[model samples]
Target: MTVVDVPGSKSLTARALFLAAAADGVSTLRRPLASEDTEGFAAGLTALGYRVERTPERWSVQGSPAGPPHDTAEVYCRDGATTARFLPTLTAAGHGTYRFDASAQMRRRPVAPLTRALRALGVDVRHEESEGHHPLTVTADGVRGGELALDAGESSQYLTALLLLGPLTRDGLRITVTRLVSAPYVGITIAMMRAFGVTVSRENTSRGEVFSVPPGGYRAADYAIEPDASTASYFFAAAALTGHETTVPGLGRGALQGDLRFVDVLERMGARVRVDDDRTTVSGTGTLRGITVGMRDVSDTMPTLAAIAPYASGPVRIEDVGNTRVKECDRLAACAENLRALGVSVTTGEDWIEVSPGTPRPARIATRADHRIAMSFAVASLRTPGITFDDPGCVRKTFPAFHEVFARTRAAWGLAAAASPDR
Candidate 1:
C-alpha cells in the first residue's frame, strides 16, 4: 500500500482568493494550491490593488473594503480559464476600468457567456477584439443587480463568477441559470460562499435554477482548502492499473470537490473503495470492468478513466462532457487521439467517448499542454512499458512536481522503472 499527500484544491484556491480579496477584512487560506493557474489569479488580484501576502504554508489576502482601488488595471490570465472568467465579474463588482486578457491558448476558449451576463447585469463591458471572447475591457460602475438570466452551458465558471459577486450588487441579485453545465461546481461555489459567511439561496423554479443572493457582504474568516480530488484521481487510477492498494490522505467522503465522485466511477469499474473522514483508499481487484457514465459534473477525471479503460474487461463509455472540448485543448479529441496512439480502440462524438479493451502498446503520448492529459496517461504507463510523454512538464500548471511525486510513489510500489526519466 502506498499513501500520497496530494496538493490543495485548485478550484477551492481560486474561489477562496476571489472571496477573500472581496470580503470585509483580512482572510487567511491554508495549504492553497501554488501553481501557474493560481499564481495567475493572485497576480490579477494584486493588479486590481488587492494586497496578497504569500508564505510557504499559507496565504493572507487583505480585503478591499471599497473594492479594488485601481481605476484602470490590465489583468493577464495566462492559460487559466477560471482566472479569466472569474476576474472580470470580480472586477465589475467594483467601480473600475479594467482590461482582461489571457494567453494564446486561453484566448481561444469562450468567455462570452460570462461577459454577456455581466453586460446584462449593467456593467460597461466591451469585447475589444472578439464578440464573446477575451481581450475585453470593463468600464465598471458596479453591477446594478436585479433579476438577470444567462446561459452557462459552455463553462460553469460563468455561473460561479456571477454568484461570487452576487452579494455586492446594488439591489442584491437573483440570477436564473438558463442553461447549466457542470452543476456540481455550482454546489462548490455555494458551499464556499457559505464558508465565508454569506448565504446563497438556490431554488428550482419553472424558469430555471434561481440563485437569490441578498445584498449582504462577506465576513472574512480563516479557511483551509482540501486536497484536490482531481489530482487524487491520477493516483487512484494508479492502483487500478497496477492492482495495488493506494490511499490518499486529507480527502474522503466529506470532500468538498465534486471530482471525488470519480471514486464512484472507479468502484463501478470493480475497484474496492473505502472512504473515511480523513482519507480515502482504493484497492484494486486485479481486474477492471467497463461501464457507461455521464461525466459532465466530474469531467476533469474523464482522461483518467479513459487511460484505465484499456485494462477493462469490455468497452467503457463516457458521455455528457462536451464542455471539455473548449478546455486547454480539445480534450475529447485529445483523449481519442492519445488512446488510439496507445493502441486502444476509441470513438468519440460531440460529448461522448467509448474505449474498448486492448493491449496498450508503448507509445509517446502528446499531452497538448494539458495537465490532466499528462497526469492521466502517466497512470497507463504503470501497466505498460515504454509509455512516455512528450509534454510532461505541462503538469506544472497544476501539479508542478507531478513526475517526481509519481516517481516516488511508483518506486514505493517496487515499480522503479515505471516512471524513470531515462525511459
Candidate 2:
C-alpha cells in the first residue's frame, strides 16, 4: 500500500502552545496541524491577549514570557480539552480574572482534579455550572506555588497543565500526583518541555509521581512536529483487516510519541512490523491471533486495537484502561456498544474491555463524536463490506483529512472505493 504521512501530533501541538505561551519572544512553530483542537488552542491564547499569527505552514506566536493577560477577560475554549485544561493553569499563574467556557462534549470531560489542584495552590477557581465540570471562572489575584497534590487518574492533562505552568509560579512548584494514568503522556510533556529549554525533575513514588520545574522561560527554536502515531494506529489496523502491507513514513526511529507502541500491538495480532529510521511498515499475515494486553502504558491505542480485535482468531482482552471512560466519550462503553452493533461478541467493565472474534456483520458504526472512535471503526470497515460510519467528520478534531487519506490508501491497496458520509 502507498505510504501516508499523517499530520502533526496533537500531543505536540498542545505542548507547543504551552511552550510558546511561555517564551520570551515570537516563537515560530512549523507544520502545526490546523485541526479544530489546535485552532481552539490558538484562539484561547488569543483570548488571553497573545498575538498568534497562523500561516500555511507555520504559526508565529508573539509570547509574553512574563505571564498571561493582566486584565479580566473570558476565553471560550470550545471543544478542545487541551485548551480548556492548560489555559486555566497558565491564567492561575498570572494576575487576572478569567472565565472559561467549552462545548457540550468538552463540558462533559472531567476537570475537578485540575480545579482542585489549582485551588490548593492558592488560585481562586470556581465552577460556574455543574460544579467540577466546565464553564469555569478563575481569578488569579495571586499564586502560591510550592507543593501541591493532584489526583490525575482521570487525565494526564491535569498534571501536564500544572507542570507547564509550574515554572512561571513564584516559588516554581512541585506536584505530587496520586494515581496518575497515561504515564506515557507525562513523558511526552517532559520531553517537549526539555526541547523548549525548561528542565523538569520527576521522581516516581509509591503514592504516585512527583514533578518539579524550575522557574524559567522557554527557548524559541525552529521545531518540526513528527507524524501522529495515534493517527497511524488506524492505518496499522487497516493492514491487519485487509491483509495488506501499509507503510507510514516520517514516523522516525527517534520519534518522541509514545503511541508508537501501537506497532507492538499489531505485531502481537500477527502483523509483521518493520521499522526503520524514517518509516514503519505493517504487513498482515492474512490472519490475526488474539492476545490479552495491559494497555495502561499505551491506552490511547486501545480503541483502534479493539476495533480490529473482532477479526482475530480468539478473544482479545484489553485491560488497565479505566481512564478511557473519562475521555471525549465513555470510550470503553462506546467501543463495546459499537462492536456489538456490528454483531461482535463484546464485554466491558468500568476499566477493562474484551472482544471475541466472530463473523463480520455489516452495520453503520456510531462514532460517538470521538475522533479515534470514528477512525478506528473506519479501519474496521475495510474488512466488513457494506460497513458505514455515522458522522465521520468527527475526525476533524485531530485528523481533518482522514477521509481523504483513507481513500488514497484504499486506492493504493486496490480496495473498492468507499464514499464519505455526510456529517
Task: Report every candidate's CA lDDT.
Answer: 0.89, 0.85
Where model 2 places Cα greater than 4 Å from the true spot, the runs are none
| Candidate 1 RMSD to the real structure | 1.2
For candidate 2, lDDT tens digit of each residue in 299-410? 8899999998998999999999998887888899999988999999998887899999998687887888899898888888787767778888898999999988888888
lDDT, candidate 2, residue 373?
Answer: 90
Highest-TM-score candidate: 1
Any residue pairs clashing in model 1, and if so which?
none
TM-score of each: 0.98, 0.97
lDDT of 1 at 13: 96
- Over the stretch 192-290, how does candidate 1's per-residue lDDT look in tens digits? 999998899988989898999987778897999999999999999899778898999999777888899899999999999999998999989999998
